[model samples]
Target: MSIERERPRILFATDFSPWAAQAEAYALCLASTWRASLTAVNVLEFQPGMNPEYEVNRLFLAELMKGATQELADLKSRVAARGISLHTRIATGIPSEEILGAARAEDSDLIVVGTKGKTGLAHVLLGSTAERVIRTAPCPVLAVRAEPSDQAGKDSHPCAGVGLHRVLVPVDFSDCSLEALEYAALLAQRSGSSLSLLHVLEPVSYGLDFTLSLERKRGEMRERLTQRLAGFVEALAGAKITADSHVRGGLPADSILDSARTLPADVIVMGTHGRRGLSHALSGSVTEAVLRQSRCPVLTVRSPKFAAGHRRVIPVS
Candidate 1:
C-alpha cells in the first residue's frame, strides 16, 4: 500500500488502562500530525459465567457500558482540545478478537495498541492483546510501549514523537523488508524523519573458522550488500527523504536494537510474515525479539505473501 498516496484510517483499541493511555498519546500524535480520522474503541469483556441475556447481568452490563461511554466521551474531549476530532466505539467479546474485528470492520489502514515492555515475561500482556494484534492485524500495527527505556527517559520523551525526527528500519533485502522501506519512506516524507537502514550479517556456517580467505570473502560480501543498500537509499532520493544505510555483522535482533538505541530512533518500522520452519531474509523470530527489546514503538507492516505453513495470499483490507 502507498501510505503516502492515501490518507490512512487509524484505529486505537484502548482498554482504559494506564498503558493504554500511553498508546492513546501516540494515536493522538499520529492522528493530529497525519490529519487522519482517529477512532478509539474499548471492548467490554464479558465474563464467561454471567450471560448478558439475564436481567441482573443485563443491568450490570448496562452500568459498564454507561461508564465506558463517559470515559470515551472524556477522551474525545481531550483529543478535541488538541484539534483532533475523535470517533469512539465500544465492543463486546474477547479483546484481541474484537480488536481485530474492529480493524477489519472499519477497513483501517493502521491499528495502534498499547503495551508494557519489560524484560521478557511474554513482553506485552495487555491481555496479551498487543502481541496478538501485532501478529494478525489486517494492516500495519503500531505497538506503543508504556514508557521509554531508562537511558532514553533521561534525554527524551518517547511519547512526544508527534514531530518525528528519525526512523530506524531493519532490512534484510527481502520483499517483506522492501515493503517496510516503502512504509518508512512515506513516514519520513510526512514527518521529515531521517531513515536509518540496517543489515546484519551472520556466519554462513556454524562451525567455520574466520580464516584469511573467509575474511576476504566476508569483506567482499559486505561491500556488495552495502551497494545494494545504497540502491534502496537512491530510490528514495526523488522524494527528498533523507535516508542512509549501514551493514553490520552480528545477530540480527541485537544489531537492530543497538542501532535503534544509539540513534535513539523515534520508531522502528519493519515487516513480519507468518512463515515458519524455513529461513527467510527476515524471520518472525527476529521481529518478535526486536519488538520485545526496542525502547521505541515498532510499526510492523504485514506482508501479503506467506511461505511454508500458510501459503495463501493475504487479502488487502
Candidate 2:
C-alpha cells in the first residue's frame, strides 16, 4: 500500500497515575517534534464489588471521569500552545483491550504509555498494563519510562535527533521482523540516520544439542544472516542513510539491547503482532521486555498505513 507523509498521530493511554500524567507531558513534547496529533485515553475497569446501591461508588466514578476529561483537556491546551493538534477520550473496559481497540479505531501510528518501570515479582503481580498494551496494540507502542526529574532530560536525549539519526532494527527473519525493518529503513532514509541492521542467534543448548558441530552450525547461520542483510541493503540501494549489518549470538532481546548500547542508537524500532489471550499467555514475554530494559526510547510500528503500504517520503528539513 502507499504510505502518506502525514503528521504522526500518537495515542497516550492513561490510568490517572502520576506516571500517566508525566506520560502526557512527554507525549506532547514528542508530538511537537513530528507536528503530530495527540490523544489521551483512560480506561475504567468496573469492579464486581461495587454495588449500584452505593451512591459513593457512583459519585467516585463520575468524579474520576470528570477529572480525567479536564486533565486531558488541559494537556491538549498545552500541546496546542506548542502548535500540535490534540484530542482526548475516556472508555470503560479492560485497560489493555480498550487502549488497543482505541488505537485501531483511531488509526494512530503510535501508542505512548508510561511505565512505572517495575520488575521482579512486583511486575508479575501488577502485570504491567504498559507491557500488555505493547504486546497487543495494533500500532507501534512507545513505552515511556517515568524517570526521576533529574534524569528526564537524560532519558529523552536518545530521541533528540529530530527524527531518526541512528536507527537500530533487530531482525529475526520473521514476517514481523521484516515489517519492522522496512519501517525503520523508511524512517532512516527520511531522517538520514545511519541504520544498523542486527540479527541475534540464540545459543545452542548444551543440554539438548547432539547434531551438527557447534562451530559449523554457527558459521552456516552467520553466513545465511549476512546474505539476508545484504538483500535488505540491495533493496535500499539509493536510500540516504548508509547501512551496516551484524549477526550476534545471545537471547534476541538481550542481543538487541547490547547492540543499542554499542551502536548508541537514537531510536529502537520494532514490531509486535499485538498477540493476546492464549497466544500472549503462551509466549508470556515480548518486545515490551526490551522497552523496559532499553536505555533509549522505542518506536513500535504495527498496521493500517495512512495511504498505501509504501514508505512515507518525508521531505528533508
> Would you estimate the TM-scores of all the predictions?
0.83, 0.79
Cand. 2 Cα-lDDT: 0.70
lDDT of each: 0.75, 0.70
Best model number under lDDT = 1
The sequence of per-residue lDDT tens digits that candidate 1 reaches over residues 1-317 is 23443456789998887777767778877776676778999999885677789998899889989989999988887776677788888998888889999988877877998777544444422325766777777888888874633332122232353436889989887777877777777677666789988898975763556588877888899999999888877777766888898898788899889988887787999888734333531344677678777778888888432212431111111
Worst 10 residues of 2 by lDDT: 152-161
In candidate 1, position 245 carries an lDDT of: 87
CA lDDT, candidate 1, residue 153: 14
The alpha-carbon deviation from the true structure for residue 77 of candidate 1, after best TM-score superposition, in angstroms, is 0.4
Q: Give stretches of model 1 more than 4 Å off.
A: 47-50, 54-60, 118-127, 148-163, 204-210, 275-284, 304-317
| lDDT per residue as tens, model 2, 1-317 | 21235677778897767666556655766665555777888877755566735898788778877887887776666556556676788887678888989988888877888777677788766767787777666666777664534333233332332334678888777767777777776556545567788888888666565656877877887999898887776666556557778888889888888998897786788877766677666675547678778766677765535355555322111
- Give stretches of model 2 more than 4 Å off: 1-8, 16-18, 21-26, 48-53, 150-164, 189-192, 206-214, 277-279, 302-306, 309-317
